[model samples]
Target: MNTPTKRRGCFRNGCLALVLLPLLIFAGLFWAHRSSQALPDRFVLVVPLSGGIDEVRNESSSLPFLPSHESLSLQELLFVLNHAVADERVREVLLDIRGIHTSPAKIAELRDAVEKVRKGGKKVTAFLRSAEDADYLLATACNSIIAERGGFLLLDGLKVESLFYTSPLGKLGVQVQAAQWKKYKSGIEPFVRTGASKEYLEQINALLDEFYDDYLGYVSKRRGMSRSSFEALINNDPLVSAKKAQTLGLVDGIASFWELQRQLTRKVSGKELARDNDVFVSGARYRSAVAWPQKGESDERIAVITMSGMIVHSAGEMGEGIDIEMLKNSLDAALEDKAVKALVVRIDSPGGDALASADMLQMLDSAAVKKPLVVSMSGVAASGGYMAALAGKTIFAQPLTITGSIGVYALKPNISGLAEKIGLGRDVVTRGQYADASTPFKPLEGQAYNKFVGASGEIYDDFVGKVAASRKMSIAAVDSVAGGRVWTGSRAMKAGLVDRMGGLFDAIHAAQQLAKMDMGKKLQIILYPEQKSWFESLLQGRSASLSDRFAAAVKQQVLHELLPQRQLTSMATFYEMLLTSGQLQMLAVMPSDIIID
Candidate 1:
């Protein structure tokens, strides 16, 4: 009844439909895989506090053919800990702290979370393969600490190391002229001096003593030992074998991981159970299950804006760093949100560009007028970090947080000697005598040098004045403790710089009190500058060829060996600060890159 051409067309259309159906089915299955993954009803959450904990998580773009490497985030980890404590399905928690590298304040926050879980009647156990000062400090927060048999325990007290670039610069025929507002402002010392200045040594030693005392206090209280006895144990033998540490009562037991799991199961149920009978869920997996908005039908919210990393004009890439433009936008968004009852600004920065810091301070100051604002200082909130904190109604810092480096300085790099050594010359034309005032090829002198120093003095005066006004102290009192000197949070509190010693959540509660919100109520905490979507991340990520990756790897290794990672990051930030200021400008950056181990 039909023509042969019509029959052939129908046959081709049928083939097309068959091919498209399989593709659609595959896509649907792939999309629904996450929903199908079942979470255990009764499980122990195993949190791997391994590797560096970035303040925020950002995924870079890569080819579809490449594998993805995702790291854990501090914010998400904290959220999981909070959720698990209240989660009826979670019975216990196990923290695996092998090969974990993080700053002191982050460790403090983690410890606080662990303590919360313990107080919530859930058993928290920590297992360490190699225990160091930071790792042991975190382990003490757990209900029980387990270590691998014969593993190394390096509880040696913290020491901060600094590198001086004077000799190296001299050999390379480079001249670095720098000026600070005061004598104790040592941010420029590394490039100008061969050894640690007397003031710098005094401040560093005092800080070390404060941290050591705090560490001893915590361990002694947790282990039920006298402070004197604990000090003796640490001083007599800071480094010991895992078995020795267990014998000394530092750790509860030394056992293999399988045995530890069995022990944990018994602790949870008071019955010996086989490893296979136990159910465990990873932190990331559990976060996926629980880290969603459980917002009580209330419209009121509390905005927690995280300003971590170097404070710069802009953050070009993801990683961790404070971008002024981004922060301003976040503040504007929070201000615009009528439901936001209060604002909590968490700062973990060693500081950066003065202008950018000023801009952020202005934004925060403006916000405080509208809402109750509180600041929580993390690991290293010195220099411009402290500058920003002045805007807060109250400031809270972890006991070991480094702060109070309220000073300013400018650096001028003169490479004329290096150029001459290489037999290079340049012909320049200028309209004014100081036209090339900021050029690295020539030395700054005469009126140029004086002007630079004067500007630095002005910025320092401004910083000190702000601190005096905020802390209700005299200019002399603020300047006496300032001059680029860093302080432990305890000392800062005593000095009237910090209001109290606490973690970020504590600051949030403080904000609540100020906002007249009820205590113990779970208020919605909103993160500003919301994270990007997967598609947006892919667009932001620009993939490089294999050769470029190798080069970057090599460069990273060299920098790692040459200096601490923080120092390298600070150096990059320093250059960025210069570029943003567009002049021989002053910087409100920490004098020393603090690294506690």
Candidate 2:
């Protein structure tokens, strides 16, 4: 009620208002800045080939909107290299080879792609911290090859070793009960027996020998070294010292990345860069100072379908990447598209979802009859990977392509004895005599055991029959290689399973050939996961930083893992590994082999 108290209250209210007003203003400025950040206009492409194909994410999904300068996808790498050869602004290519991992098939593609750049009157230089034999396969294509100071280049003979785990399973009381349908179907060998089977070893040895020969031949061609000399170098791989590597003529020079950069910018217009990352915004959206030449859209209108990652059973929401239902929808849409002249199903999958593969193949068969359906395989196309290719009018594979595994096996853990050891037993009552047929909780009865084996036999039979008809081989010939088998792309070609040994562009050309198109005019092709547009970016907030993004991704991944699913599986991790050529991948798959949707 006093005048002094009222004045004090008024003073407090004004100060509080002052503090809140500035807070609101700062928040608005931050949002506005993110939305209207200066448009990036220059790009320096640094191609560091990383793992597999990654889909474009929304701004929140991928942040800072940096045009990808770090690691380029196989396709993107080719495009940039192609552009550099002719474009004046794309002066030089700085390729880093520290973490590049790829199969032999992929190695060939990169080598050829870079070689084309050199042929086009462009300068290409490669800087590697440490170079392996495989790394050299790619770097050899570059005009100038530089290795870090004390960085060793050990381009030696290639080795492919198969891992066998029969003894481990035996110690753990694991029983691998199943069939051997093909002479080389050694996928199950690691589970049941120690070391490679005589049948499996024979095929592996033959294939490894072929791959080694091809590798040495390629190095010899690029390095201009004699075959005898190259053989001697390979036998003495893992050079004792970096200085020695240069002395032996295995490397052009040994210097750090900084020295390499100093040499690169010697005649450039702008300031010399200190680091590789600063040279080009890694994983950032490219906005060139000179207008980015708009990617020419396909006018010829050829259909393209993408098969990505390990093909596993389609049950949950299309997890992380590839999904069966998502693919099914794409297939249906492509089949219905009128403008698509023919379909090119690009398969980079290691193979998953046995039933799904069959279903997808059927869709391809339908599309092929209507128009040319060509298959373009990258890196890998094995087991289910090969199965999907069967749907093509013609299949294109890289020479080092990983393919073939034309067989099937069904396995379920029988832990009944484990339960007994734990003083627990499962009892079941069923109206049907064989209702408990697949109860892994209990031991298999004589009659139930017979039924399980018989069922697996029927499924394997169905698989072989399809292979015989698709490859146009006799039942006998097909059987010779159809049991839970595996084969490299080169071997698959000789076996008459794959149509040709080539790349994606080759597959596109094959499509043109199949349709009898003119060679002089460039062809238009339709590809899946259509590139994102700038319009989408303008509407959303700027992409977040890496730390913020990683936190969000972890949250989403955790929720998906803990959620309920309507499917069954046995050993989710093992299935994924089988698909990815022994690369360990873990999935929370159900306990039985079934697809819910």
* TM-score versus the correct structure, for each prediction: 0.86, 0.78
Clashes of each: 1, 18
Query: Could you give candidate 1's per-residue lDDT for residues 1-597 as a string of tens digits?
Result: 986775464367678788678668646754664563467668789988766776655432222222223446777778888888889888989898876666766777788988999899998889998878778888899999999887978876778887788898788877678988777778788778999899889888888787777778888899888998877877789788888888889899889888887776676666676655646778766765664533534667888888878887768632357888889888989989998989999887888888788888988998999999999997778889999999999999988888988888888777778888999889888998888878878878899888888889888888898899889999999988998878888889988999998987799889989998866667878886666533344334469644455345445445544553342555455754443443465678887765445
Off by over 4 Å in 1: 1-33, 36-38, 60-71, 262-278, 317-320, 518-520, 533-585
Candidate 2 differs from the real structure by a C-alpha RMSD in angstroms, to one decimal, of: 7.6
lDDT accuracy of residue 12 in candidate 2? 72
The total of clashing pairs for model 2 equals: 18
Candidate 1: residue pairs that collide: 61-541
Where is model 2 more than 4 Å wrong at Cα? Answer: 1-44, 50-61, 65-71, 270-294, 315-321, 443-445, 515-525, 529-572, 575-597
RMSD of each: 5.5, 7.6
lDDT per residue as tens, model 2, 1-597: 666655565367678788678668656754664654333233345666544323122112222332223344566555456556655555667777774555566677778778787887767777766777667667778876777797676665555555555576446444445444444555555556676667766665665676678777877777778877888876855553567766766667877877766665554436666554234433233332212222334445566677765455553523534566667777677667765667788876666656667776776777789888899887667766677788887888877776776765554444455555667756677898867655545445687667655665675677777788888899789777666455667677888878888777678778877876666675555556454343233334258754344456445445534552322222344544443342222121111111100
**What's the residue-level lDDT of 30 in candidate 1?**
43
lDDT of 1 at 260: 81
